[model samples]
Target: VLFMGITFVADGFGIVATDVPTTKTVVAQVASTVFGPDSLGYFSFQGFTALILFLAANTSFNAFPRLAAILAEDGYMPRHFAFRGDRLAFTLGIVLLGAISAGLVALFQGDTTRLIPLYSVGVFVSFTISQAGMVRHWRAERSAGWRRRAAVNALGAVLTGVVSIVVLLGKAPESLLVAIIIPILVGLMLFIHREYGAQARELEVRPEIVVGPPHRRERVVVPVPALTRAVVQAVNFGRSISDDVICVHVTDDAEAGERLRERFERQMPGVPFVIVESPFRSLVRPFVAYLDVTGTKDPEAITLVVLPEYVPRHWWDRILYNQVTNQLKRALLGRPNTVVSTVPYRRES
Candidate 1:
């Protein structure tokens, strides 16, 4: 109604030129007169495209999370993502969606006109599938009164499927190659992932692993890098749980190790600094070897590896450094009888 009224007003006034070849030309003229001639042509299109993108952004931020939560409840995604955060938002889904959208924006150079055909294809496909699903669901109910509902759903499915077909036929020759490719690829991945997850669950350890009580707390070996505030916090955190705290530091060079050891002795007086030799300059291997050796010596003791990590507030800060903490965590998870905990300190802005 609002759009119709606006069209009526534009037609009544001489503002919109009927002689214009395209809506883009009219938009350019209007925007140029209102804003400036500099803000015409592609700039006008870009501004309008940005506005639509902003509106569509809410679909991923709000609608996608709700849909994901529903899928998660039906065992599609991880249950953790379904939970609401302190800010009453699905933080996990929101973050994931934001990351994906940002990647798309970067990939397409933020030209939403290029992205729209692809977006429309997915929207239509989903609409068609959803309508078909509803038809099936209504049919399965199969009551005397459900005949009307089933007919309505069947009609809806037909209409949506036709629209989807029309969109595919009309847009494919245009800039919709990505639209067709992405959805098919995504659907295949989702199918493969679902099958893998199902197979994994089926082959999982039985009553022995699932029903039994958790193992008792064993010895904890905390490897501290150096006597920094972060390391101090990690050591204190580890000590709180278990008194068996052995700080291991891997050194590629002997001289560097000696210098670090002397500094450690001065800063952390009583804490023993065990130096591990690494000729390959690998940080993960020596600590893993230490954990293996400790586990062999005391099989009953649980090893708690406390790693102090610095979390950067800005995304650019992460690009400056190699993510050693993430690599270390991944390596630690591969080891047996070891639980890794990260104590993160946010870098001061």
Candidate 2:
């Protein structure tokens, strides 16, 4: 009746001369017909629309990250995603969702009709899964009120499952794309789970190994970059961890190596230093080669590869500095039972 009155007012007052009587599909159209364009009411209608849409989006921000954190805890997603920000929000998941939403908006070219069907598929799928899980939970406990809960869950599961299927089958191409994407996501999640399991096995402390304190020295190796505050700090960390610290410097120039050797002797006189002559002029390989030599000599002892890293004042400054640390860490980590440690010294601009 309100819509009809709006149309009547629109036609009578000659506000918007359009043949959109039966088809007031657009919200703005109906709004303009009721309250003339550029009026307070007109702006208020659009404002409320924006507010409601944003509230719906905020729901996604809240829900998806918590779900991702749960998946991470269950070993189905990367542990990094489970980390919360200062505000206790899942920062990675929120950023990931923002990127994904942007990509999706671009993909659909801002067409809501095309977008709605895909959203419906996700919503119903989640609903169905949650209901099914709840049913299982209630059945497992079988406590007081479990029967009622199970019945509710079962009903919800059936309803949502049916709706999910209908939405998926009815919407062609878009729904088909979602179906394809879901399996790929599942495959990725499975891969993550497998990796987490493998890592857990590798890092697990067996009862046999820890039964006795076997005779082994902790050999700390500090890969020497330019002996700045960073290197000094890294060496200090190495000293704290272990008494036997060996500083290895790799250089193509024999003359520069001699200079560094002299400097090491003058500054860090007590600690042992080795000059690795790398004719190939590569940092990581020569360092790894030296580590391999150390490992072969004393197979029982654990080698601690301590690399000094400088965290610059800003993020862009990171590219200018931290390249050597990652490559060396990667190479060092491959050697079994060897722990790679980074001593970060933040550099102020």
Candidate 3:
């Protein structure tokens, strides 16, 4: 009704729609004409319209994130979308929507004429789907007034569906983008749902399965780079847990490996040392390969890879030492029945 009134007023004023630069300022133009173009009423009306538009723009920010969160909870979207931030808001969804909206605006160069067709198609399609769902609900419930409610919803669905199709056909060149994007989004959601289902099935437990102690035995493997106090501390901790502790070292030079092995044997007597030769001087690969070999030997035993890390006196001093422990931890992650433990040795200030 408001739009119709504006159109009538603009026609009466002899203001040609083509002469108007953009559809967005039509209401302001109408007000300007009514108030002699310079009156306070003209400027005030424009201010009010601007305020309303700003408030209207907030609807997507509120709706999209909540819808995304619900979809995420149902396993049709990424799980991160369902997580609430410190402010109890769906921060990721809000940020994502903002980014996509900004990208679309920039892509179209903020031209309302070009963007409106896409908006209209999306809005009417959603309206049609919602009304159709309501009609289905009314029929399923079949209450005393269901026939009337269903009839009204059915009419709405037909009207909106017609509008959606008409807009798509009329503005195919512009609205085609939305048509293409919708199917891509649907495909992505289906992929997420399938992945979630596969993961759930893999982790599913059966009633026939009897639960017992996790592992039959525990074997600790400490990777030693040098005969430092940190290495000795980790080896001691490994031995305290189980007598089956093996210290490993990856060295390209055999002489250096022998010197470390001698020092390790002398410091921690009776503990076995395994030196892995890495011709390429690669650390993580050779270390992980040695672990895989040991794991293959005793599949039932848990291979606990304990790494020794020296704590820098100052936070900024950490860059001086190589982050071998962090690298090894990342490389060994997700290996079956393999646990990575870190033993931090605090250094003196």
Query: What residue pairs clash in candidate 2, if any at all?
Result: none
- What is candidate 3's lDDT per residue for 1-349, written digit by digit as tens? 9779989998898765543444536687789888867899988998888888888889889989999999999999999999999999999999999999899999989877788899999999999999999999999999999999999999999999999999999987989998999999999999999999999999999999998876568999999888888888899999998889999999999999998888888878999999999999999999999988878877988889888877677667578764888889889889888889988878665
Q: What RMSD does each model have against the real structure?
A: 8.1, 5.7, 3.1
Model 1 residue 250 lDDT score: 87
lDDT against the true structure, each candidate: 0.73, 0.86, 0.89
Q: Compared with the true structure, what per-residue lDDT tens digits does model 1 show for residues 33-61?
A: 55676745657656876787689777668
Please report the TM-score between candidate 2 and the true structure. 0.73
Q: Per-candidate TM vs. native?
A: 0.55, 0.73, 0.86
Q: How displaced is residue 231 in candidate 1, in Å?
A: 7.0
Q: Candidate 2 on 141-254: residue-level lDDT in tens? A: 999999999999999999999998899999977887788888899999999999999999999998776566657889899988667888889999999989999999999998
RMSD of 1: 8.1
- In model 2, where is the ten-residue run with the lowest total lDDT? 17-26
In candidate 3, stretches whose alpha carbon ends up further than 4 angstroms from where it belongs are: 19-24, 139-148, 207-210, 236-243, 309-323, 326-330, 333-336, 342-348
TM-score of candidate 1 to 2 decimals: 0.55
